[model samples]
Target: MVSFKFIHTADLHLDSQFKGISGLSDGIRSFLRESTFTSLDRLVELAVSEQVDFMVISGDVYDAQDSSLQAQLRFYEALDRLGKHGIGVYVIHGNHDPLDSPRMKTGKREHVHVFGPEFEQVTAYRRQDQRAAAVIGGISYPTAKVIENTSLRFQRDKDNSLFHIALLHANIDGDPAHETYSPCTQQDLIASGYDYWALGHIHKRQILHELPHIVYPGNIQGRSIRETGVKGCYVVQVAEDGGVNMRFHDLDTVRWFHETIPIDSIAGEEAFQTQVEERMQEISRECPGKMSIVRFVLTGRGSLHEKLEEGRIAVELLHELHRRAIRSASEPSGLAGLVWVESFDVRSGPWIDREALLKEDSFLGELLRYGQQAREDMTTRAEVLRSALNPLMANRELRMLLNETDDEECAGWLRRAEEMAVLLLAGEGGGESTDED
Candidate 1:
């Protein structure tokens, strides 16, 4: 009987640019820019403290083909720390950081074992007694265009005594958001007969199987608004009877969160501000100790919509929320923690009941009906929009943004337009329109 422990992680994406985040204060931007390195350092610290036999990084050690030398050096330094403590590291390159990537650097440390473009195996030893504890099999992408089923190449060790682990950087199935590189399937991995499967390429942590323990540890940190929540890795323990135990460890330095709150029940501007503050408090409780970058979408029909759309309330509210977050971060009480509003969007409609308004034979009813018809006929609406937008399309940037006006997005535009029309009509009827004009 033998037992060993290991840490499984992937998609470091070291030094990747944080996209879709703009107009942030200098302090916040600096924190975001250095968060990736901080997360990796925390991971190394965890490995050292736990004294795990080895660590497995499935892929994407670097973000792009032109990863900075500073990122490479920082990664190597972390590995060197692990090496000093007699810990081994297993690494593979994903599509983003393939073997042929011009910026990928060769490791100078003896403890780091990087898999080649072909399937290969490496043996890790237990710290207590330098005996072979497990056999790890993995493959790296030679170039960025690898589309073969790399899992089929994996083979389990014949020795039944030692644990077997397979590391892969692939799209298990086709995911529209992700490029299909090194495509494989669950059935393919199950057939390999490995004790545990460590996967990468997906930025969301998921457990695809349990009988043999197939897991994706997700990425070390979130690089964009799209990649949200607690990003981290897994610490797995294999017992003598082959019983596998796994635990998730969050390593993200900064967290991203999206929350939508209904404001229909609230009345004045003061009440709306209070509601947002309460939501921020709730977020603080949910994500304790971590800096939160949140995007709040206000929803539901309400009188506040006109005010929200008219004045500089949204901008001022965001600044106040940011100040609150900073104050919370610095406070010793920790009653309200650090939570910054990255963006605040108003999706709320007019206070008038839409169904009731539609029944009336007034101008507002006709306007509502026209808007509904346009929403249903998106193709026709798009043509009309294109005609009006054609002159503005001369600007390359604006044209690029409108290149792919999908059906869903078009529907959203129509809905917002309808809401605005209702608000305008309500204002004309002396229903308290807060339009600045």
Candidate 2:
């Protein structure tokens, strides 16, 4: 039995521009640009420390097809360091970095093996004896759009006694969140007769299967709020009996987080503000040494819900939080910015006693009753409204002027309209009948 150890990582996306998120300070913008390279440096450091046999980068080594010279140089520098340790590298270009993409002229890179445009097999050699340790089969995207199932082309020799691994930058089972590049299914992989499948392309990490271990190590860094949480890679050890043991390692220099705060427990505006600040502190503590880019979502009913309904209130709160974050960064610890608010959303319902309002015989009671009916028939009303508006949207000019409206947006509009009507009809107190009032 031949035992081998290796690191499986992908989606380096070196030098990602991060166009998805905006309205950031210059400091944060600069940090984001250098983050991928920083992650690469950490990856190299981890590989050397772990003393693995080889590192297989599944794909997307660069963020774009025409990668910048700085990104290429940084990548080569990391590879060269791995080479110095006699650790090998197996790489395949993903849709983002295809065969036709412009690659830097780094001369001959030692101990680096990259698969070509077609499915083929290669070997990671044992350093001391130069013996074949693992048979790796993989393919690169020819020009970015890989319409076919590239995994079907992967073949392994059943007669061989060596450990087999398949590396691919494919979207298994057509993940709706990602493009269907090099698309394949779990059955396709299982039929290929490989001991392990190292995958890439998707930015979220998960294990798809086991026995013949199937894994996705995700991307090295979080580029946007959409790609939040811990981003990293995996180290796998194949035992003498063909059993596999894999462990994950963190590689992100800065992380992204989305936090939702329920406002139901808060009694007033002051308490609500305190809760927001407290949550920010907690999230910042969760990521002590690294910068945390966070998106906040406020939901559930409370006394402050009515206050948040004013268009400028949420905006004011967001700006206040931003100022607090800036202060935290400039404080005596002298660390760079630690927390940033990506976006703040207030989606809580109004804090009104509907039963009491409905008991009243005035117009406000009728209005509340009508609003209740609309809420109950929200789906039917949304469909009716969309049906009426679809014909108008069919016109090219109107389509250009107006955005498409989904059910959620329609419901929100109806809710806000009712809330506004209540505020106007019920006056300053908003016809309060709460226990405290």
Candidate 3:
């Protein structure tokens, strides 16, 4: 066995086109579109700085079924840069970039080795000593949908003297968050007896086991709000005794954040605006040199809730924040240091005494009681609530973007609806009775 160091990254998703994000200026949109490439550049820079022996990309180097010539060339060029540094690159294709997809031709370089549809074995050699470092086993998806378990077919190269690594892109144990392509279990992987498993296809970074080091480095860049937070890869070093050490390096050029501001105690509008400004300033310091896409969720009951929807206060505040962000990004401080306010969601409700409302004998009180009952019995109410909102759920556009509502999600929506109805529909005369009786 020999000492070695390498970077393990997956789901580069180069040239990613974002979805469900809109209302951006042309300049901002261009910046958003170029973020994936920026992150890739950063990843390459990290690899060179760390002086890794090699780099392993588990899957999904491209974002589309058919990779454009420009993307292919750019990817090849990145590998050429690695070649200059005496770093070898091994790549596998996932469901997103299956080997069967038609791709534009790019000049092949000697440093980059892309796995084919079947299982293959490759080896990484240390540049300084010309000693064998590790033997890597990998396979690629023949097509977008691989029903069979690809992990089962991987046959280790029978060279146990060196560190053995398995590279795969799979939905481990059929994770519901992603499509169940090339599904396999942890037991199956441990049985393979590989020293390290570099996995892809799940954007959330997780370490399933440490004895043999089964890990998911996660996507280098998050493409949507659903994939929020800092995204990056791992740098792993193996010692002569075969002790594996892995550390995460943040390479996401643009970050995604969902922040909730509770305004239950705040009464004045000036105070509310002050709170928002302070939070924004604090968030700017988090990832100092990267653009942050933020979605502000205003939660908790307050006087501000009355103005949020009725007088278009929420929308107005969102626009004012957007202007501030634009001004900051355009300054000499740099656009990368600014926070982009992606959206503002008003989930707060008007200040009201729930105990008093429950005690009243009015129709509104009766409705409130039933709503609570239905919410409590979510196991049975989920179906009924979904059926009642069938028209909205059936909207073709909604179906394309969202998944079927689960019980917890359905219950939360029901709760929000109840709160909103109590505040908005209760007339001005009704308000004299109690915060809208």
Candidate 4:
């Protein structure tokens, strides 16, 4: 029986979409971009601390057409640390880091083995005293497009060749959410006869199978709101009796969180603050030391809707929380040390400008009725409402045709389109003439 462990992670995406770092301070943004290395360093630290036999990086080491020299050097430096500790490293290029790219170069290391585009059958043995070892077979993305399933390429292990593990970077059977690169199915993976499958490409952590374990470790850190929450890798422990237990290890340098707090009876900003604090308190307890940048969405209907819908309140709240935390030195150290509120979108059912709406025959009331009627006029409301507000659509004939619309059923149609048009006009400049400008 051989008792050993390994770390699995993918999609590091070093230096991805750096242009959007404008909101962060120059130093902080630079740190965040370079923090991919920091996450990897944490992985290395974990490996050494745990005395893991090896580490496997599935793919996407960098997110660019060309990997930077600094990136390469930094990667090797981390690997060099692992080497000193006698930990082995195995890497395979995925869709983002294809084998044919000039950005990636093959190098030799006593503690490292990188699979090529072709199936490379290899085995990692337990320390010399152990009687058995695990066999791993894998391939890399040759070019960008791998239309056929790559699982068919993996050959079953020879008799008595130890536990078989297959590593590859591709989507398994058309996940619409992921890029269609080297699409293979779970059935294909099971049929391949590998004891385990280490996958990459999808940023979300998922387990596709358990019979012969198939898993994606997810990205090491959340890059944006799209890739939210506590990011990390997996720690796989293979027991002496051959039972494999996988645990997720949070290795992110920064944290991204999205939370929806229901405001059924919120009275004011104090209520909002209380709700937000309660949510943050819970997240802090759950994620501990993660630098939680949050989107505290106030959901449901309540009296506090109008105030929240106003300008910059969410940003102000986030900034204030961050300031308060820093000033009082009351932050949770387990987090990565930043709390930014990304956005506060309003979805409450409360009506805006209620007092104006109660005033009969008032402009606000008339507009409200018009909106409700327009929305209800499912048939011609879209076009009629568009023509009504858009001065550019002010062909006198069309406006007259639109103005003739008087049915109360058309309220919903007008409301929806008018609201959309209001937003469009506000951003692009009001009316058809301004749109042309």
Top lDDT hit: 1
Better of 2 and 4 by TM-score: 2
**1-437: candidate 2 lDDT, tens digit per residue:** 56778999999999877744665666667777888998999999998988888999999999674499989889998999999999999999999988888886667776998899878888777765677888999888889888888888977788887899999999999886788888899999999899899999999999999977889999999887778889999999888898999999999978888789888898876787787778878877887878888777777767677778775666777788777666666567633437777776666666666688898766778777876777789665666556756888879988765564445556666676777777676766546545652
C-alpha lDDT of all candidate models, in order? 0.83, 0.82, 0.82, 0.71
State how far residue 291 of model 1 sits from its true place (Å).
Answer: 1.4
Local accuracy of candidate 3 as per-residue lDDT tens digits, 1-437: 88999999999888878755766776777887788888889888999999998999999999664376767778878888899999999999999998877787667777788898888888889867778999988999988998888888765556468899999999897777788989899988988888899999999999999878889989998887778988999999999999988899998878888889998987777887788777778888887888888777888988788777574766777788777777766677767667777776677787777677777776667667878788778554766675776776678888654465445456667767877778854544332345553
Indicate whether candidate 1 or candidate 4 has the larger TM-score. Answer: 1
Which 10 consecutive positions of candidate 2 have the poorest summed lDDT? 401-410
Residue range 27-136, candidate 4, lDDT tens digits: 45555676677787888888888877778888888765747777777788888998897777788888777777666464778778889878888767554343446777
List candidate 2 segments past 4 Å from native. 330-337, 352-437
**Candidate 4, 436: how far from true, in Å?**
39
Worst 10 residues of 4 by lDDT: 428-437
lDDT of 1 by residue, 1-437 (tens): 47999999999988888876665666667777788999999999999888899999999999775488988989988999999999999999999999888774464677889899989998888876888888889999999889899999987866655788999998887765577998888889888888789999999999999877889999999987778889999999889888988989999978888889788798888898888788878887887777777888888977788887785888888777767555655557542246778887677887786786676667787777777777778676777577757897999998888775555555666677778877777778733323452
Worst 10 residues of 3 by lDDT: 428-437
The positional error of residue 132 in candidate 2, measured at the CA in angstroms, is: 1.7
- For candidate 2, give the lDDT of residue 436: 55
lDDT of 2 at 388: 55
RMSD of 1: 5.4
Model 4 spans with C-alpha error above 4 angstroms? 1-3, 17-22, 104-107, 128-132, 281-288, 310-312, 315-337, 351-437
